[model samples]
Target: MHDIDPGWAWSPVEESQQPWTRQLAAHLYRRAGFSATSETLDEAANKSAAEVVAELVDGRTESEEYLAQMKQLGRTVVATGNVENLPAWWMYRFLTTTDMLREKMTLFWHGHFATSGDKVTDPQLMVDQNELLRRNSLGNFGTLVAEISRNPAMLIYLDSVTNRKAHPNENFAREVMELFALGEGRYTEDDIRELSRCFTGWEIRNGRYRFNRYQHDSGRKSILGQEGPFDGDEGVAIVLDQPALPDFIIGKLYQFFIADEPAPPAELLAPLTIEFRENGLNIAPVLKRILSSQLFYSPHSVARKVRSPVEFSVGFLRALEGSTDQYALTSGLSELGQVPFFPPNVKGWDGGRTWINSSTLLARSNLIQSILKNKNTRFSNGTLSDLFDKHRLNSSQEIIDWLETMLLAVSLPETVRLQLQSKIDSGSGNREERLKEVVHLICGLPEYQLS
Candidate 1:
């Protein structure tokens, strides 16, 4: 039903029309990373769409000082034995980092290959695994999946640590096919059993991957119609060779970057699947094609993805050039059903409409309210008047227009816009305080939940 037009162009549009430039920049940032500030959007507005996409895709590395800071934080978290604090530290990084796409992709892979610190309590192990994801965030997908197979946190989380020769654990093997590589029904029950045997010797020791040869089945196994004396590495290699792998990953990328409902049909994804597979499973090329494609700019793709809690949180903070208490932010996010390193289950957050039932919607509003109220919170743009004066916005209508454009992907109705302007004009507080209330209200809007 959701067929892509074959006539769609994959080349980048040099410059969007004047008004659409900022809007498109915001959309790009929301999908590529978190949202960008007005100033950042202005900078991007001067560039071509291809330029922006390239800048996001080829992100710069973190500086040595930044690396030192992250290392110190890691050491402190390990010393305290409070692995939970990892999310708080990460929230701080998300708020302040310039390597937006790298961090954003790290978050994506975290959900894609969901492993929780809750199960594998070693803070160092979790930290190591996170580094692994970040390093390979946009690298070769086959290499990444192979590395993940041996990651210490993954081994423990998927119960592969106890997968011995006699009694093989199927959790890791089953998930590798069903969730990680190929989707359901692509492999049979016997495949899971045989794959488990292939990975039987994988274990963790001293927070690192250790292969125990004696415990390994080391037997000839059949998986994805391949028969071999396969071990964990060979098992992963066979899994990656499946015809279903590219399509499965591309479908996931669509759900993440494009619309969620009316799923992108297999027909719509065939081209991307071909490019991804033919290019040796390197993610950057596929992402470039998708982001630059005519399809990416369509109405069906824009403003269609429901914002996950992390997306919402990161975007809000980035828009205001704001900072909040990390602990409070992490706590609020957990209540909103996403806590970075602690995905709800092995399957991760079922993102899309699932992000906003009644309870979560209310919790999201309450969290924004708390952030606005917090004394520690800081917005680089000062107050509403400062922003208005800086931008020369004298009227409530103009102010509302700018705020709504920056904050919401979808436009508010005429009546609703006027109502918001009225609130801004007559609200009983200083300009900053009133603006905070305005922002709080706008953020709580149902439309704000979308990218």
Candidate 2:
């Protein structure tokens, strides 16, 4: 990363140098969303890399019918009056949604804002907040911060549901500075105190955000060198104005979309930080720039991220065009550490290498095994064998190559490949069972844990 030129790194790749192939298309799909199916990858490879990314960034929007169906499904889940069921609802969306980048960004913001369902027990509130994140996922960062500050679920989770003028709650204020906008060390304790005062009287009343003006602290406050009798929105705007905000947010985005380790230096991120601030904090442009950049398609980013549980499982099923019981899939994800709308804590999951360990590795394997064994699991609306046959993958090597192309960010070791072939050749079951078992084994490999 240090040796890479910032200009060349960000410049769009020329076709003469990096031809838009199925493998590169797979990389884009894996990073931008869940992994794509072979068919999807083929479709993407037909166009220029810039065209595919542009379409992903600007063209994909869920149809009205799709939105209605998802809404109905969400209503049905919330009707159960159990917040526990919300994860399954979202898992369904992850598996089925056509607008992949938007959903992916929504997941990014969910971790960024880091609200949790454990405390905010109302399923409807959780669903509403999820929708809020999705709605503004690819829009202005400032607007997201303002709206989320007043979100009922966020207020409830942060213990700011009943902030009063006399004793203002500092949870949301501290988080807004330390986690959401400026990152740690960018704001002082005094700043948090002053900012908390701005949010006084902001409370949740009858499942809605309410400002009790009588309880509000209308006193002048000094925050981040700015002085004013600030309200919650104004306080948020001040925080957003801080110079550290763009670097903090863009750094996180770099980690989420690029490599997680060897954090990019400030100089390397200077271009994006400037653009993010100059563009009024609009998210789509930054995303478009990153996705289409030479750096994103290079070795530094490809296979650079450790697969989060959601990515590991969802990407596998998506790559295979497989479907399974949403409830069970949600359970598997919880075991693997991430459950949508139920992040472990305010910091959310520390992704990358944190997603891998002996325990999690085993859990990942178990989850894949469970999904394969589940009666409801189906690939291309039939058996895995049927899907493989559709793709003309008859031999073990052909199937392995296909799976590698669709599912792995890196090539499998020749030793592992040989072992898998041996297993498939010697396994004591039918062809479909052998193929499924080999895929499960491949997924357990360290190579498959990336991207």
Candidate 3:
């Protein structure tokens, strides 16, 4: 296998005449956004890999109307005081929004930061944090870390608001080092204690950040070999300055976007980490490198991750070019063990193979079927058969191939492909029923579980 080039930043790979094949476009979409639509695949097939990466990174934007709608929905949720509905609302945006990459990164950061509404219990605060993450999702990492440190949802969730001069709560401090910035074993107990002291008096007042002067510990402290009378924000900055920070973040990004089971070795990530740090922790550049790198298109990285429930549910709907009740999708995702605002715990959902179990797998299948069965699900601006008519895909074989391209990340075995083709050919109903049957079978397969 070809190793990822260290100079992948500016070096464009040689482009073939057919550079943007359906397979490459599908891989790009699955990793960078959700799965590709037929329209997106068609458009991308005409562009080079570099152009596709650039556009996926910078071309998309959320519309003002969508922003207004999201604000209204959030206001409604906040007024109702049911923070639980935030996930359902987010699913609505995910289903309809044009800016897929932003939403995708927001989801990634949600998992990376791993704060839950279960702890905060304020709908508005959770909504605020979600927006903060989205705004800075592709922005600078340093600013994001500093802002998240003071985010009301985070302060409450990690007990940082309770951290004070006399009695310091180390939960937030420990997590900042352990989970957010640096991985475990990179910091000491002394670091956690000192960082907690630095964060003293950082409290939430009427749903906003308030630093209580009386509760603050003003004494000098030493953390990570630096001594100062540092505040919470400064502490975050100091931690971000650590040399180990880049490797920790890059590895996690690799796990999320590339392979997960057999973690990428440190040697493979060293060059990328340098680029990440040199670029001032702006995620877009590193992402551009990864998405455009030779290693990304290699067999070792493709189809290497299991789709999170959100990915499976949202990507499935997007692929069908269909729409459904967001409430149903939300409930179905919950059954699959991932609610948007409500991650199971601080560590968030354990993805990968843990996404699939006996019961959850059943729930996944039922959810896809329910979406397909929805009366409002239109393909090609009409019914499912309209999809066939619009695409000129009439035969059973062409329909199967199209569905496979849209749905499966991994290749199906020849025997399994033959069996599915047989099933489609043997169907008694018309093209719609045959298409649905073939698609349903494909979704239920193990291959579809992987991204």
Candidate with best lDDT:
2
Candidate No. with top TM-score: 2
lDDT of 2 by residue, 379-440 (tens): 99999989999999978888889999988999999999888888777858797888888899
**Alpha-carbon error at 72 in model 1, in Å?**
2.0
> Candidates' lDDT values, in order?
0.86, 0.91, 0.84
Task: Give, for candidate 3, the lowest lDDT window spanning 10 residues.
Answer: 9-18
Q: Summarize candidate 1's per-residue lDDT along 1-451 as a digit string, tens digits.
A: 3455634534344433323478888888888888888889999989877888888888685798998898898788878787898999889888877888888889989998999988989888888888899999999999899999999899989999999999999999999999999999999999999999999888877777888999999778988888989988888999899999999999898888878877767877888899999999999998987777666776877888899998998789888778889899999998899999999888988999989999999999999998888888877746556656777778889888888878889899888888889888995777677777888989999889998
Per-residue C-alpha lDDT of model 3 across residues 1-451, encoded as one tens digit per residue: 1354445422444332234487888988888888879998889888878888888788656788878988998899899888888888898888887777778899999998888887778888999999999999989999999899989999989988889899999999999999899999999999999999999999988999999999999889999999999988888889999999999999888888877668766777888899999999999998888887766776667888999999998888788787787887788888899999988877777788898899999998898888778776666567777877778887767877888889888788889888888877786777667767777778899999988
Question: What TM-score does model 2 achieve against the real structure?
Answer: 0.98
User: Which residue pairs collide in model 3, if any?
Assistant: none
> In terms of lDDT, which candidate is stronger, 1 or 3?
1
Error of 3 at 388 (Å): 2.0
Higher-scoring candidate on lDDT, 2 or 3: 2
TM-score of each: 0.96, 0.98, 0.95
- Rank list by TM-score: 2, 1, 3
